[model samples]
Target: MILEKKVPELWTHLLMVAFAAVCVYVFLPSLLIIYKIIVTVILIVILSIDLVLIIRKKVNYLKLTRLALVNLSILLIIVCLIFYTTNFLVLTDANSLKSVLGGSTLMGKLLFLLICFLQPIVLPLPEAVTIPAGSAVLGSFNAAYLGYSGTISGIATMFLLARIGG
Candidate 1:
């Protein structure tokens, strides 16, 4: 009985970790596309198995529904971002992106900052792409400062979102 109780708890934590890992993996540029896809698939499979085991072991329906909704929302957002980027964005090079972002105007800077700000929360852009471009356009110091602020704000927004969801 004790072991049974512990198993569910263990699976719950594992599921959370797997989900978090997958989310982190998706945005951070890995060495290769094939490796990324393979690892993500394994993590997702683990997550799905853990979810099934936890559900089978008996959990509250209300909590389950809330969890499902939050997961679904995140998946939807990621899918939409992928679709938008693939269909609308043409420039894949960092230098071109830097030129566009660095229009050498106040409005351009603000837009660049905004992109950095949303990168974590909504945009599925790798930091590699944004940071280098920002550095070239805004210089190292200004780019770092703006990027740091945007990242922090994005993190805070995610925290608020999790709180609201719960």
Candidate 2:
């Protein structure tokens, strides 16, 4: 009986991960309409299955509900930030993005560091964006140092969160 319950919950968890990957990898980066339609279809199917499972009470609905809420909230926040930031800053290119990072200002360095740190764990900003920008503004060695530092710390924070939550 316990195993029966656990298997469905495990399937649900796997489905959620797949849904998130499609959203992050397929839908978020691309602007093509075809990709958007595909992502929408994939997401709809995944959500439908999860909803059916919850409706049938085959898995723990409460946990799945909380997970969905949190995931949606984070994705919404990231999307809003992307649109708002792009409009406000008018970042037309990678060079423009680097300029916004302030080149060598202390606040800019801190902000860059913060972005790098938050990016791996929370923000969906690609490492390609962060690392190359940092290298351009802060020099190759310094950028590499900061990038590694932030990445390591971010991974450590993920481990800490999982340990505490689990």
Candidate 3:
């Protein structure tokens, strides 16, 4: 019984690790296109399983909600990639992106947060463009904190709207 209860929790952590690993490859991109394509296919399959579980009511409501959110995030990522691959959004230089955040740490943090928060819904820009630039400006820790917080808030807002309207 305890093992059964712990399985989902373990799977959640593993999924997060898989997501992080795929995102990290965008930074150290050596033959990354091939690798990302492979991992993305795997992620898609994992997401499909989650969707089946959610639709079948195999998980509790909380887990269902989480699955929904993660699925939405992955869809957003695919949208961003589509824009990127089709050249709808220009790939500006990282220095330019950092300069846009300005010099001071506080201002840099706020601007990074704002950009990351708005990127998904408003701009359709990917973190590949923002996170590296933000890290160069605010250092790794601050950049990661602001980026994650802003992203979570944006995603939560999206999920709330879906919940309200669904």
Candidate 4:
């Protein structure tokens, strides 16, 4: 006699829905802010709901860890892709951008850093290129320090905004 665990059809449907959500997310590009937010929220809600349902039905530590790792890996890869594409775009016009950044003066570098800090939040532009561009013009040490600090500040501001409700 062979013993097999039976699973409900709804389980298959849920798995398919999760796979489709992942596929759609992989294909979705950063376009409109509103659309992106809406789609992301929907995907997140669906995934969370499914994860909870699955976890409640069967709690496996190893499987949960694997799922977490997979999700982190996907997030990391998408972030890298965004940065890679933006960095290449900035690299091609390095000289012109360097010139436009107004040389290696302290004020100019600060301004560049400021713009980079704001680009990710205030402007529609991606922050990925700004740090690289800064590195090309303002030196690596300066770019890294300023870029990270500025990014931190911008992120902090966003957190405050989210907490305070506009």
TM-score of each: 0.46, 0.45, 0.42, 0.40
How should the candidates be ordered by TM-score, best one leading? 1, 2, 3, 4
Q: State each model's CA lDDT, in order.
A: 0.66, 0.68, 0.67, 0.60
The sequence of per-residue lDDT tens digits that candidate 1 reaches over residues 1-166 is: 5346656555565656555455545553433677556656655665565566556764343255346435744764585568557643643468777778766667757867887788788877788988888888888898898888998898888889989986
lDDT of 3 by residue, 1-166 (tens): 5346646764774566466455536533543478567666665665676556555657554365456447645654675576456543333557677777766768778878987777665666678878889888888998899989988888887788789988
Runs in model 1 lying further than 4 Å from the true structure:
1-88
True-structure lDDT of candidate 4: 0.60
Better of 3 and 4 by lDDT: 3
Best candidate according to TM-score:
1
- Candidate 3 Cα outliers beyond 4 Å, as residue runs: 1-92
* Candidate 4 Cα errors over 4 Å, as ranges: 1-96
Q: Which model scores highest in lDDT?
A: 2
Per-residue CA lDDT of model 4 for 127-163, tens digit only, reads 5656677787788898888888888888888788888
By summed lDDT, the worst window of 10 consecutive residues in model 3 runs over 83-92
